[model samples]
Target: MSTPSATPATPAARQSLTMVCATMAGAIPMMTLVLWFVLAVDGIGEFPESWPLLVVLAAAVGAYSICELVGFRTPPLQYSNRPTAEVQADSWRRFTASTFTRFAVCEAVFLISVTLAFVADSFWVVLLGAVIALPLFFWEAWPGERNQRRFAAALESGGIPSYLTGRAQD
Candidate 1:
């Protein structure tokens, strides 16, 4: 495994991945907000338990932490040593899949809160979920430079070429 040296990504690759991240980041919040609005207006029903709120908040934090620690780390596979285009493609697939999984987990936290809002007839639950999830969505799911570098380093350590992650050798 090679250590990834920090380098600028190719402009085209950077733009393409950036577009992917942008679209995903935009679509997720949009979907979550739309669902929340529909339920807030017409779907909430009163339920008398508040414990679920704490449970949901705890679950959100736990889930995000687990995903952060585990999802981004891909082990070196036998095929990773090949250094072929197929390897690059596989690396890209893994990277994108991990990205989507992280995003989905974050979105799930908010969606769960939204569901709780409908069940408990409490908008505060939704707000709490957003408070936990939105910052994570930005810090982890948004394909900012820091995240791009992190993923690049991970992939590089797993034997993928840095170019696939829009990085060059130092």
Candidate 2:
């Protein structure tokens, strides 16, 4: 019987992944613009407001940290006795899902900051949140070569390959 051959992920799939990363990164600038517009129209209204807003900001940051920590530590896809292609596809799917989740968390934090800025009319507060969140977003959501290799290795039978040295398996 002829065995099914494994193949690298298609170019289209890679492009789609790239687009997803780009979209996630774009959230930062988008939020910044929205904040600016709101501030320009409304002006900074008040400062040293209630403790609840501060609590919400802290909670948002904490939630973001937790999501990033969990996403990095956990493998979205577990090894299974299955066809190579199936495993590869599943691995990529999991990688995408995890990445999206992380990005969403980052986006949520940004949105919350913007909302707080709008409601409190305090630029400094949102700026502080953005300062904290932007780095976390870049660190956690930016998909680099290392991330690609990690995702690819998850599809390997042994799951020991930390990096792909050559053409990816089909």
Candidate 3:
């Protein structure tokens, strides 16, 4: 697809898709955080034997938060109020940043949560939560390598043409 960074002269379709993906990048993490909290509250497993899983959980969640924060704070996306393609590009950049920063933040949050659970003896919630949640996380995150290709193909196919045609009327 024609990513905004594909080249400045890239078709508006590519740029537009890039923007949508970027916005998605920011949006997903916010949702993940909510789900993570829910899972934490529910207790899928214990943190003692499940430290590794907790780490994974925290990292994934943090990635989402970091991505959202970065996207929300993005220079370009925040630059204008139009809510269009350029915003997408800027927002996508946050998603990219999330790919790295998310791990750190997620880990930190998990550790804190685990500690709090332990100190407060809120064991069942976190332990059971981890047990039930890990598999789901793996499966949910598994589309790792396929995301970009799938999105690119989705965009390159017919999205742009339709969008442009619709926009032309305005």
Whose TM-score is greatest here? 1
Candidate 1 C-alpha lDDT tens digits along 108-137 = 887788777777776667767777777777
Off by over 4 Å in 3: 1-66, 69-98, 128-170
Question: By how many angstroms RMSD does model 1 differ from the true structure?
Answer: 6.3
Residue by residue across 66-162, what tens digits does model 3's lDDT show?
A: 5345422322212335455553454344434533343334334444445545554455434433443333333222224333333233333533311
The TM-scores, one per candidate, come to 0.70, 0.65, 0.28
Which candidate, 1 or 3, would have the higher TM-score against the true structure? 1
For all predictions, the C-alpha RMSD in Å is: 6.3, 6.8, 13.0
Error of 2 at 167 (Å): 7.6
lDDT of every model, 2 decimals: 0.67, 0.61, 0.40
Error of 2 at 106 (Å): 1.5
Lowest-scoring 10 consecutive residues by lDDT in candidate 2?
Answer: 160-169
Please give the lDDT score at residue 75 for candidate 3. Answer: 28
Give me the overall lDDT of model 2: 0.61
**Winner of 1 and 2 under lDDT:** 1
Q: What would the per-residue lDDT of candidate 2 be over residues 1-170, giving only the tens digit for each residue?
A: 99766854344545688787887677677777677666755564345476536755775667666664566544434445676555555555666776777777866776677677766777655665666667777777666556555555544535433223134434
